[model samples]
Target: MIGLAPIFSYDDQLKRFLLEDVGSGDVTTRSVFSYEARHRKASAKIIAESDGVFCGGPFGSRILSYSDPMAKFEAIPDGQPYAKGECLVAMEGALESLLLCERVILNLLKHLSGISSLTASYVEMVRLLRKSSRSLRITGTRKT
Candidate 1:
């Protein structure tokens, strides 16, 4: 809940990201999964590979929703701390939809969580170094 941008703000970018990954359709998934198989429901979880300040669950949910409206996405609340092997996001939906969106979702979560973890470490370091100054602020540049 840390000042997340409006979901609309990401519409174009999200479309572009999905398009980039799913260009010309997911031929492999389409070829491999029969109509009945594609419709079969399945569950998946994105598990943390290391401890960090977790981020991007909401975004991942949004991505899944975009890919398949019927899909259910449950995300660990953003900005929370999670340990290695913890579930960061849980999704239930058609197996085909899950397969299609998996890589993109994982890539996004990894990038965002890395930033969140690094920023948390910096903040913690500052907090420990200056216990008296309550006004010290940590800011970042526009560079990503």
Candidate 2:
């Protein structure tokens, strides 16, 4: 079925993210680029600075939408593995909007992908051990 990326209900929280990150204004951006920057179209790839499994696609999409309604971001879907320097997220939109959301989106992707990669490693280890011990089972306990 075809469906648009549903605008998550956590828009307020997302707005807070923008506010916290931007504050009064993007001083560096303002000082660095001309007012013409806002009118320019731009594109970027969120490359994997290190090898990992990708995660946080939905959240990254939300951040893009929250930053600019017309902006678009794409990743190879969550839980997919990507090699170092591979494009994890691709975005295109107004130059200003793209730059504005860049760091936050990358930070979320990196953090979530890091966890996913770590979990994959653990799964691989457990599977290897389980081959020799059929009764072995992975168990997890959580505070929540």
Candidate 3:
């Protein structure tokens, strides 16, 4: 079977890679923009493109919080059903902070959500198959 790319030597390295990708600072966002004078909340809507058992809602929420401590996070609990185009989580926060954190948030969402989707697909396929009958019954009848 084909293997996933960049197979880490250590299991914990995946989170390190993600943090490294984000870097110590987002230089562009920091240099180019100024914080707005008045406080305002920004809502980030996480919409699922396809049906999947939603598995990473909390991680996605934590991504936002990690990006900006002041962010207000609300998410449908993890391991719940999420239909296509449904909102999984929402964050209300400062516009500049939200923009700075959007990519990281999406990355987490994409990765864990994909895992959930693939697992669900495998489960559904197994559920539809007559595995015991196909293997055991076929073997017994053939022997007779």
Candidate 4:
């Protein structure tokens, strides 16, 4: 299987997304639990919603693991094609831990999957246009 190397970056896209979603801050998580809160281990499964060439499973797992070290993930091999509604990866860890990492993991997956679907759509459109063009031809007509 082709291994599309994962990109581990600390950049603005993610930081901004977190800032927007977290709002003033994650007051809920912080208020309910201490700054160093810990919780029971839990599991989460990431699944694809549509059919397309699968990518970024490893990237996603890495992002999740980085967000929460205690979180463990098992993802299908990189560049492994998967079908619609396929389980891309399984995450196991503390509820708090998983929650903390959820957005980053999803962001990575979303970016990769969105690009895959868009490329597929563009390819299909090109194929259809090619077929249509092949059906037409220029013909010579006698001048009256």
* TM agreement with the true structure for every prediction: 0.86, 0.84, 0.68, 0.60
lDDT of 3 by residue, 1-144 (tens): 267666554224434644676667667766676655223576777787878777666665555666567888777776677888988777888766677667766777678778877777766666566564442211124454
- The 0-to-1 C-alpha lDDT of every candidate, in the order given, reads 0.86, 0.81, 0.67, 0.69
Q: Which residue pairs clash in candidate 4?
A: none
Relative to the true structure, candidate 2 reaches a TM of 0.84
Ranking by lDDT: 1, 2, 4, 3
| Error at 106, model 2, angstroms | 0.7
**Best TM-score among the predictions, by candidate number:** 1
Q: Could you give candidate 2's per-residue lDDT for residues 1-144 as a string of tens digits?
A: 267765565677666777788776667877888989864889999877888898998887888786688887778988888898888888888887887888878777788888989999988888998889866666788757
What is the TM-score of candidate 4?
0.60
Alpha-carbon lDDT of model 2: 0.81
* Model 1 CA lDDT for position 82: 94
Where is model 3 more than 4 Å wrong at Cα?
1-18, 37-39, 135-144
Candidate 1 total steric clashes: 0
Writing each residue's lDDT as its tens digit, candidate 4 over 1-144 gives 279755655544555555565655456676787545547677998887777665677666655554567678888776556777889889998776677767767777778877876666666677787787755333446897
Better structure of 3 and 4 per lDDT: 4
Put down candidate 1 lDDT per residue, 14-132, tens digits, no spaces. 67777799876678989988989988999999888899988888778888887789899998888999999998888999888898888888988899999999999999988976887
Clashes in candidate 3: how many? 0
**lDDT comparing candidate 1 with the true structure:** 0.86
Ranking by TM-score: 1, 2, 3, 4
Report how far residue 7 has shifted in candidate 2, in Å: 18
